[model samples]
Target chain A: MNEKIRHLREQMKRLNLEGMIVSNPISIRYLTNIQAEGTLLITRKENIFITYAMYMEDVNSTLTINDEVIVVDIKNISKDEFENFFLFCENVGFEEGYVTYAEYKKIYQRYKVNNLVETEGIVEKQRIIKDNIEIENIKKACEITDNCFSHLLTFIKKDMTEKQVANEIERYFKENEADGLAFETVVAFGENSSKPHWIPSDRKINSGEPILIDMGCKYNGYCSDMTRTIFLGCILEEYKPYYDAVLKNEILSLDQIKDGVVVKKATEIIDENLKRNNINLIHALGHGVGMEIHEAPIIHTNVESYFKENMVIAIEPAVYFPSNYGIRIEDTVVVTKNGCIPLTKSDKNYIVI
Target chain B: MNEKIRHLREQMKRLNLEGMIVSNPISIRYLTNIQAEGTLLITRKENIFITYAMYMEDVNSTLTINDEVIVVDIKNISKDEFENFFLFCENVGFEEGYVTYAEYKKIYQRYKVNNLVETEGIVEKQRIIKDNIEIENIKKACEITDNCFSHLLTFIKKDMTEKQVANEIERYFKENEADGLAFETVVAFGENSSKPHWIPSDRKINSGEPILIDMGCKYNGYCSDMTRTIFLGCILEEYKPYYDAVLKNEILSLDQIKDGVVVKKATEIIDENLKRNNINLIHALGHGVGMEIHEAPIIHTNVESYFKENMVIAIEPAVYFPSNYGIRIEDTVVVTKNGCIPLTKSDKNYIVI
Candidate 1:
């Protein structure tokens, strides 16, 4: 069996689960490398992936005999066949965080399992720590992201719309060896930077205005996210303190992120620092980055978890003035035993074009 | 109150639901034009939108006094304040399809409601029929999509990579007034067209090969989806029959689509027609299109429902041969009393680029 599925089975055994139904497509891809829309059944003796007829060809092409995953077409299976897949298992686990209430009820009725219990995101927790392959993919994606930022610094000019800049970033990523964007690229100009999750608009960029770009790209199914707020022509005198404070907190947060450090404590320190500057950290300090842009180990005042080695995360610190402008500095990093190493190594010094 | 929320309240009254928690972002956007990550509570006497601090500005900006949606910051609200939002409510409905099992339990515990029942996609059901504004947005999106296709015909050349073509389509959409892609643009060349949901790759286009481009764009908030299978240089003799059969069924299916027509019968006829040509309809005939690319009134053999007037949907007829090429002709149309008028009026005739 593959390492991921074996690790999952070990966790299932510890939870006393003899069977499990993995429905989330991301989880399925993580476990079996099958990127089809399907439900994966880990029974007592068999590991089966049930997909639609349309995806059968793709699924088979992705699978090898060594993977030991049986691909089943949903159309070829009968109601009895479906129910019998997990008939003998005493306890079957499901992703409580992913499966909807209606789907949970349907699975219970259709599979006829004795006890359907909550797995409580077992697969997601396993994904929090990046394997070597995942880390390499993320590193490559981060490299491409840094290159894109460098290209944008030269390409961005006055009168360019936010949408135009966003499109160019997407085009750059696709043209490079990257597999498109990790998420929708956010390119906010001037006052539009005040919105943390601002969608790119057609607003034209002007001289002496803040340009916030939060973008990422995917490389081999892994994601990398980085945000940078730069100035056009020159930085305004009033925005310097806010920019310095955000950059300082961003670096401080990264410095505190290491294996064995409490996530909540690190986030709290950044929050206290920002508070002293009369600013507030509205969002989480950072989040685990992997196949999905956002994953577990959310760095916040509420989450009381310790950072672990091999955990890839994005550390972002920002101060937003409502209806004005915002300054944010972010980096994707890999947690180490004593400290963290930044993957997105773009210069955070006050940059002007 | 807005017309959408008013209609929702009417539905709530019929269902005997005194309160409802709308957690789905799309549903919230549909009911009240506030595009933020928040929970909208429809209480007995108020429409409240609860969001985090970061999104407060955007949500408030999107809201008007006429919207009557009171924006609440989640940070300012305590545990007791949250529970009291649904106080005195006998039955509070939640979207069973959208809310996960874990979230459903959390909502039940946090709200302290008398009964948390399933709303059974009330908002989605209401969204099936397009309002005048929604139809106009969809039509505008479709117009942009048709323009993008016309541009691709002139721009696509031999030796251009699939990814390059896909990126150009995205750039075209963004350069125009369209709001990015409705979904990821699929640009398949040669045998890559065999897969229905093929992601664009670096594979170069060659002469005398099939090129399938399934793409869409979003204008305002509405989406447009279209698929055309054209020849790169020339059509092979073996592929002509399959292409003709798909196009024939595509027209036949659209001709039968009208207000009061049974959706299942329409799909069944298409399926029978394809089977007569020794081909099987692998996927759904089409689906409703509006704010989301895929919405209600799924045109499939299992769905037993009547096509209602003003319902915007995509009618796609496709046939795929394994390890070979496939042909799919699709269009977005508006169902009227007499027949359906296509919004995406791209030519279905075979064109050799």
Candidate 2:
């Protein structure tokens, strides 16, 4: 059996689950390395993948016996055959966080399980600790993102629209051979930067205005996330404090990230430091990133999790002045024993392009 | 009140639902023009949108009082305020297809409703009939897609990897001012075209082989999907029958599309025609395309739906020969009273690049 599936089987046993239906694409990729449309059924005896006939050729060519997974076309298998796979299993696990209620009911009827148990995000918990290959892919994705940012610095002009710059960032990622964007590229100009989740619009760029960009890309199925806010021509004197506060807290929180440190402590430091300057850290401090852009172990005031070694995450600190401007500094990092290593090598110093 | 919401109110009355909680982002965009991260609640007296503080500014600037929707920051309001919106309601409806089981439990507790009922895809049913503005946006998206297809024929070469061509397709859309892709662009080379939903790989395009490209993009939130299969050099004589079957059925289906026709009949026609040549119409004939690339009134053999006037859909007819080659011809169209007008103007004829 593949090591990841074997480890998952152990976790399932601990939860008193005889079998599991893994539906999340990320989890399926983590276990079998098959990135296609399908459902993975980990029966008591074997791992079976049910997919449409159209994908059978691709899945067969990509996976093998060493992966310890059998691929079956859904058309060739009867509903009775699917049910028979779990006839002896008393309890089956399902991804409660991802499956719809309607799908949940369908799984129940199709498998005819006695009890369907929630895995309680067991797969997500397993995904937090990145393996070597995962780390390498994430680091490469970050490298491409940093290169894109550097390219943007040279590409942005005063007359260009915010949407144009955003489009160029996406264009850069694809041309440079990174899989499409990790998320929609956020390119906000001037007062539009006040909203942390602003989408790029057709507002033309102007001198002495702020430009905030949050962008990332996926490489080999791993994701990278980074954000940088820069000025077009000059920085406003009145916005100095807000800008400095965001930068200082973003650096402070980065230094404090390490194994065994509570995730909220980083958020607390940002909140307390920003509060002293009459500002607020309104959003999450960070979140885990992997196959999915946003994964487990969210860094926030309400979350009670601690950082672990080899865990990949992004930390973003910001202060927004509604309808005026906002400053944010973000970086993707890999947690270490003493501290975290920043994967995004983009310079964080204030820049006026 | 907006007409769509008022129309939904009538559906709600028939379903015995005094209140409805809509969490699907597409559904939220369908009712309100605002497309940010939020949840929409339809109560007896008013419509409420609850979003994070980060999105409050954007939402406020986009939505107006005439839209009859009140925007509230989730932080300033307690769980009690959310419950109060639906306080007097006897029964509440929820989207069964979109909401997960875990989210269903959270909504159940948050609202404290007496009865939580399934809306039975009521919003999706309404979305099938395109409004004038929606049709215009979809037409524009299709126009952009057709232009991209024209560009691809001249840009594609024998040495380019599948991923490279796919990336160029996405770049073209963004550069042309389309709002990203409707779905991931599928670019297959040689035998890779046998898989209907093949992800672009590093396989280099070879001469005298098939290349299949399925791509789409959104314009103003409406989507357009199109597919075309062509030869890198010359078409293989053995693959000629498979190609002709797909193209013939595609055109035949387009001619039969009109108001009040059963959707399954189209699928049956494709299936019967292909079976005579020992080919299969392995997938759905097509699906409705609007705010979503794949929406209501799925054109499949099992679906019992009738064509509606002004409904935008894509008819994709395909034939796959395992480990060999495949051909598919698809076009997005608007159903009219007499027939259907092609929204996607890409040529369906075989091309030798």
Give the best candidate by DockQ.
1
Q: Residue A55 deviation, candidate 1, in Å?
A: 2.7
Model 1: residues with Cα > 4 Å off, grouped in runs: A64-66, A237-242, A274-279, B64-66, B76-81, B84-88, B237-242, B274-279
Tens digit per residue, CA lDDT, model 2, B1-353: 88899999999999899999998998998999878888899999999999987677778888876789999888887878867878898899999889998999899988999889988899999999999999999999999999999999999988999988987898799889798899988998888888888889889998999999999999999999999999988988987877887788888887888899888886787789878878777788899999988988789888778898999999998888767887888999999988789999988887888
Model 1: per-residue lDDT, tens digit, A56-112? Answer: 887999988878999998989899998998888899999989999889889988998
Q: What fraction of the true interface does each of the listed models get right, in terms of native contacts kept?
A: 0.93, 0.87
TM-score of each: 0.93, 0.91
The CA lDDT at B229 in model 2 is 95
- Give TM-score values for chain A, per-prediction: 0.97, 0.97
Put down candidate 1 lDDT per residue, B173-271, tens digits, no spaces: 888988778998889988889888899998999999999999999998889999999997788999999999999988888788899989988789889
All models: lDDT?
Answer: 0.92, 0.89
For A232-318, candidate 2 gives per-residue lDDT tens digits of 889989878888888887788778889999887767876888899888778788899999888888998777788899999998988
Question: Which pairs of residues have clashing backbones in candidate 1?
Answer: none
Clashes of each: 0, 0
| Candidate 2 chain A weakest ten by summed lDDT | A262-271
Q: Note the DockQ of each predicted structure.
A: 0.85, 0.71
Worst 10 residues of 1 chain B by lDDT: B52-61
